[model samples]
Target: MLEEAEFDRDDAAPIDMLESYFAAHGWSHERDDDEIVAKVKGSWAEYELRAIWREDDNVLQFLAFPDVRVADERRATIYETMGLVNEQLWIGHFELWSTSGILLYRHAAMIDGEGGGTLTLDQAEMLIESAIDECERFYPVFQFVLWGGKTPKEAIAASLIETQGEA
Candidate 1:
């Protein structure tokens, strides 16, 4: 459950901390009044990280995604892949934004107050790392579907084959 009382932007927005976090990581980012967008490079892909402060809802919404574009023709298969991928262990989930044709990982944390928990710098890092890690782990499945023309089932099956020791 979450409280619905409106909060002042200054009091509720954690944009400053978020900015500081991005700076500490040395990632290029831009911040507006209530949102920060950062560019992150991971092992498997480059990602766009977006965090929005919702004062009224006391929620911090975070989204991170690789630069893959989902075409309209493949949207249904991608959605099916999203469902299969989401069924595995998860903190956040993948979504393909229909209008934008972008696939992203999204998670939200309740920031301080009644019914809202706290968000420390460490927790924020964990939250972000979780998203990126999931993206890295599953990037191949998405690719298999979009580029390799594999069905949702086949894509996930191919990704799950744990290879032997590295070459």
Candidate 2:
């Protein structure tokens, strides 16, 4: 679990940059040295966005966990759905945390520069925005499988139905 960061805003830490981004977006967030967690409201549900920065490896991993929970019985179905869902995604992939069976979207980016791996505000915004977009787009498909008892293919199909126009 990441704790609230205690440092001057001028600090050059990547997590601090993210803290400023969250603040600008009016999202609640907490940050430690290596990780920062933010709560963002999406169209379907709230999301817990966790970003871990590794200065040594010059990498950043971003994860978005929707409020949806996969039940023990639904794990098999969700797992199958996970594979199919990942097939359609271009940015990141979805997975179920083995221990908790929690569904989450994950993406990792390699940051390389001569001086160091510096995280820019624009990069942070893009990473988080994409994650939130993917989650909102897919949350209903997970719901379709979980409660609607729809097959993986069926759930994906239902989610793709394009409404013609305004009702």
Taking the tens digit of each residue's C-alpha lDDT, what string does model 2 give over 1-167? Answer: 11224323332557777887787678999989899999988888889999999887888899999987787888999999989889988888999987887899999987765546667655676788889988988898999999997898999999978889899
**Candidate topping lDDT:** 2
Error of 2 at 57 (Å): 0.8
Please give the RMSD of candidate 2 to the true structure: 5.2
Give the range of the ten consecutive residues with the poorest summed lDDT in model 1: 1-10
Q: For model 2, what is the C-alpha lDDT against the true structure?
A: 0.83
Write down the TM-score of every candidate. 0.84, 0.87
Tell me which residue pairs clash in candidate 1: none
Model 1 lDDT, residue 152, Cα: 93
Candidate 1 local lDDT, 1-167, one digit each (tens)? 11122222213236766676677678999999889999999887889989998988888899987888998988999999999999995588999887899999999887876634345655566777788888888999999999998999999999889899989
